[model samples]
Target: MSNYIVRKLKLEKTPQLDHLARAAGELYSRTVVSFWRTVRKKNIWLSGYTMERWHTSSSLHAHSSDAIVQCFYNSLKSWRIRRKTDPHSKPPRRRRWYFKVIWKSAAIKLKGGKLRLSNGQSNSPLIVDWYWEKPSIIELGWNKASQCYELRACYKEEIAQPINDGNVAAVDLGEIHPMVIADGVNTDIFNGRYLRSVRRYQNKLKVRLSKLIDRKKFRSKRRKRSIKSKQKQLAKLNNQIKDIEHKLTSRAVSMLKLRGIQTLVIGDVRDIRNGLDYGKKNNQKLHQWSFGSIRIHLEYKCKKAGIKTVLITEEYTSQECLNCRKRNKPKNRNYRCSCSFEFHRDGVGSNNIRAKYLGIVPVVGLMARPSGLRFHSHIQCNLTDNILLGNPRDSIAGE
Candidate 1:
C-alpha cells in the first residue's frame, strides 16, 4: 500500500516573501469566492471549462491559477457530498487569506540549501533558505497564528502487510476505557481515566481564566495578554494529549500485530451524541471524549500494516449481554445480566462486537473464563511483564 507523509519546512522571513505570500493568499481567496458564486448561480459542478471561463482575464500566474482552481474544485466536491448527507450544511465561506502552492516545477524549485518560489507575475523567483530531498509534491502556505511561511513536502512510502494468522480482534471504544479489545484468546482493557482527569483539570483552568477575563475591563491590554497566555497553555495541553494518544494507539497496534491479528473490528460511535440531551455535565464529558481521533489512529495504523478494518454500527453493543444474550442496562463501569453474567462493561461490549461478525451468540462463560485478561493504563506501572491476570490496582492506579 502507498501512503504519504508531510514534512514541514519553516521559511526564512523577509519583506519580499511576506508580500508574495500575502498576494497569493488574497488571490486564492478571490478565486474561491468567484468560483463558488459561479457554481451556485449555474447550478453546475466545478470543472476545467468553468475555471477557464472564470480566470481568463485574471493576472495570476498560470500555474498558480491552476492550483487554486484545483483546490477549490476539491473543496466544493467535499462540501457537496457533506451537504447531501446533512441538509443543514452551509456553502463554503470566503477567507481573508487562502495561500497555497500548486505542485509544479515552474511554481517551486529546489536547490542546495535553498528553495525558489514563484511570485505570481515576477520573472524572478523568491529565494528562501531550505534543505530537503526532492518530494513528490510540495505545497507552500502562510500560518496566520505563527505569522510565518511554511512549506509542506509530501513523500510517498510503501506499507508492509502483516503476515496473516487467521485471528480477528474486536475493539470497543468508550469514554472511560478508550479501547477494549477481544481477540478470542484474551481480553484487554485500556484505561482512559487518566485522560479524563487531565481533561477535567484543563476545563477547570479554562473556566477560571474565562471568569477572570469577564471581570476585567473591556479591551484592556492586560486582559488581552492574559487571554493570549491562556491560549498558549491550552495549545500546549492539546499537543501533549495528542502525543499521548499517538503513543497509546501505537502500543495497541503493536500488540495486535504481535498476536498475528489479520482483521480488526471496531465499533463506530460517530453519531452517538447527535441530537441527544444527556444533561449539561454528561454532555460536556461526551464532547470532551476523543472517540473520533482514537478511531482515526487505529484505522491508519491498521492500514499501514495491511490489516483489514471493519467499522460496525455499535447500536446496543454495550446494552446486550455477551453471556446470556439478554438485554441489560449497564450502570457505570459494571455490567450485570439476569443470567448471572458479570464483567467489565466495556469488555462485554467488545466481546459482543466480535460475536456480531461471527454470527453467533457468545458463550455464557467466555468472558468470565477468558484465556487471559490484560490491563493497561496511561500511567507508568511495574506491570510491564505482560503477565496474565496481573493486579488491576497496579495497572489502573491513579496517576
Candidate 2:
C-alpha cells in the first residue's frame, strides 16, 4: 500500500518573508470570506464557479492565487460536510494574520543550500535555507512565536504489508495503568502514575497563576503580563505532555514489532466520559486524560509498520471473569471471580479483548496461564520499577 507523509522543517526568519506571508494569508482569507458571503446570500453551495468569480478580482500575488483557491475549496468542502450534520455551522471568519503560502512547482527553485521562491511580482527569488531534495508540493507558513517561517514537503511512498504471524496483542487502556498489553501468552503493563502526578502539579501551578492574575486590576499592564506568562506556561506544559505521549506510544509499538506480532486489538473507549458523574476531582482527571491522542498515535504508527489494528467495544472486558465466563465487579486493581479465579483487572481485560477476536473463552488454568508478566513505567519512578512474574516463555499460548 502507498501512503503520503508530510515533513516540516523550520525556515530562517526574516522581516521581508514574514510580511509577505502575512499579506498573502490575509488576501487568501479575505477572498474565502467574500466567496462564502456570496454563497450564503444566494443560498447555494460553494463551487468552482463561485471561487473563479472571486479569484478573478483577487489582488493576491499571481504566484499564490492557485494555492489560495485550493485552500478555499478545501475549507468550503469541510464547512459543507459539517453543515450537513450541524445546520447552525457558520462560514469562515476573518483572520488577523494569514500565515501560509503554497507554491506551485514552477514557483519554487531549490539549488544547493539556498531556496528561490517566487514573490509573485518578479522572477527574483526569495532566498531561504534548503538542504533536503525538492518535493512535488511545497508549503510555507509563518510561526508567530519564533518569528520564522516553516517549510512542509509532501510526498508518497509504498509500504510493504506486515506478514501475519498468527500472533495477536490486545491492549486495555485505562486512566491508572494507561496501557496493558496481552499477546495471549505474556502480559505487559505500562504504568501511568507519573503522568498523573505531573498533571496534578501542572493544575496546581495553573490555579496559582490564575489567582495571581485575578488579584491584579482589570486591564492593568501587570495583569496583562501575568496573563501572557500564564499562557506561555500552559503552552509549555502542553508541549511536554505531547512529547511524553509520542515517546510512550513509540516504545509500545517497538515492543510489539520486536515480538513479531501481526494483529493489534485496541479497546475503544472514545465515549467513556460522555455523561459520567464521577464528581469534581475524578471528572477533571477524566477530561484531562488524552485517550484519543494515544489511539491516534498508535494507529498511525501501526499503519506505517504494516500492522493491522482493530478496535472493539470495551464494555464488559474489564468486568467479565475469564475463568467461568461470569460477570464480576472488580474492586481496586484486582478482579475476583466466584469460581476462585483472581488476577489483575487490566490484564484480564486485555485477554478478553483478544478473545473477542479469536471467538473463544480464554483459559485461566495452569497449563494456559501466562508464563511471565512484564511491568513498564513511562516515567523513571522508583515505585514503578519493571517487575517480571513467573518464568519467561518463548511465545504466548493463545488457545
Candidate 3:
C-alpha cells in the first residue's frame, strides 16, 4: 500500500503567478456555477464525460480544468450522501470568488531547482523555486490566515512490511483521554488535557474577537482589520491542535509497532453527532471534537506500517463491564461494578472493544494497569509507566 503526505510551501507573491492563479480560480468558479445551473434547470447531474467537454474552453491545462470539475463533482456526491440522513442538507450553492488551482502529475515538471506547472499550450508555464524532490501533485491557493498564496506538494511513499506478531490492540477514543489502547495484556492511555486547554482558549478568543468586531461599524476599515486578525489568530491555534493530534497518533502507532502489534481495532464513533443537542457549551465541545480526524490519521499511518485497522461498532463498549458482562454506567474517570470490579474508564472501554473484536470473554483480572502519557508539547510527552506491562521501550520519547 502507498501513503501520501503533503508539504506546504509559501509562495513569493509575483504579479505573473498572481495573474495565473486568479485566472485558474475564475475558471473554477465559472465551472461550478455553470454546473450548478445545469443541475437546477435540467434536474440531472452531469456525467464526467459531459463535464470534460467544457475543458476545451478553459485557458488552463486540460488536466487542471478537469481537476476543478472533479472537485465540484466530488462535493455534489458528498451532498447527495448527506441528504439521505438530512433531507434539509443544502447542496453546493454559494459561488466561490476564487478557488485553488491543482496540477496533476502530467502537468508538473521538475528540472534543476525549479518546478514547472503547465497552463496549456497558449500560456507560459508557472515556475517556482523548489529545493526538495518532485511531488506527485501540486496545488496553489491563497491562504486567508497568512494572507499569502501557498503551494502544497503531495508525495506518495510505499509502506514497509510490519511485524507479523499475532498480538492485537483496540482503541477507545474520547474527548478527555483522546486515545486508550488495550491489548490482551496491556493498556495505554494518551492524555488529552493539552488539547482541551488550547481548544478552550481558542473558543474564548473567538468570542472575544467576535464581540470586538461586532461593536465596530459595518464595512469600517477597523472592523475589516479586526476580522482579518481574528482569522490569523484562530488559524494558528487550529494548526497547533492539528500538530498535537498528528504527534499523538504517531506516538500511539509507534508504541504499537514496538509492542509487535499487528492489528488495531478502533471504536467507530461516526454518528456520535447525528442527533446531539446538549446545551450550548456541551454541544460546542462535541461538535469541535476531532474524532473523525483522529481515525483517519490512525488508519493511514497504520496502513503505512502494514498494520491493519478494523473499525467496530462501539455501542455500550464503555458502559458494559468486561468481567461480569453487566451494564454499569461509569462516573467520572472510573468504572466501578457492584461485583467488585473497578478500572480506569477509558481502559475498560478499550478492553471491552478488544473483547468484542476478538470474540472472547476477557478476564479483566489479568489486565495490567494502563500506562499514562501526556503531551508537554508536540515533540515531548511525560510518561507514567507500569513496570509489569513493560514500557514502550522508548519507542515514544518520554521524560
Q: Which of the numbered candidates is closest to the native, going by highest TM-score?
A: 3
Q: Give me the runs in candidate 3 sitting further than 4 Å from their true place.
A: 1-4, 29-59, 69-97, 112-114, 120-124, 129-133, 155-165, 378-399
Clashes of each: 0, 2, 0
lDDT of each: 0.71, 0.71, 0.82
Look at candidate 1 and give me any clashing residue pairs: none
For residues 289-345, what per-residue lDDT tens digits would candidate 3 score against the true structure? 889899998898778656888999999999998789999999788899998988999
> Candidate 2, residue 171: CA error in Å?
1.1
List CA RMSD, all candidates: 7.8, 7.9, 6.0
lDDT of 2 at 52: 54
lDDT score, candidate 3, position 130: 72
Q: Which ten-residue region of model 2 has the weakest summed lDDT?
A: 387-396
Task: Please write out the lDDT profile of model 1 over residues 276-395, one tens digit for every residue.
Answer: 989999999898889899999889777765677889988888899776677888887788888887787888888888889767777655444333222343533222244211222333
Say what the RMSD of model 2 is: 7.9
Cα displacement (Å) at residue 336, model 3: 3.1
> Model 1, clash count?
0
Name the best candidate (by lDDT). Answer: 3
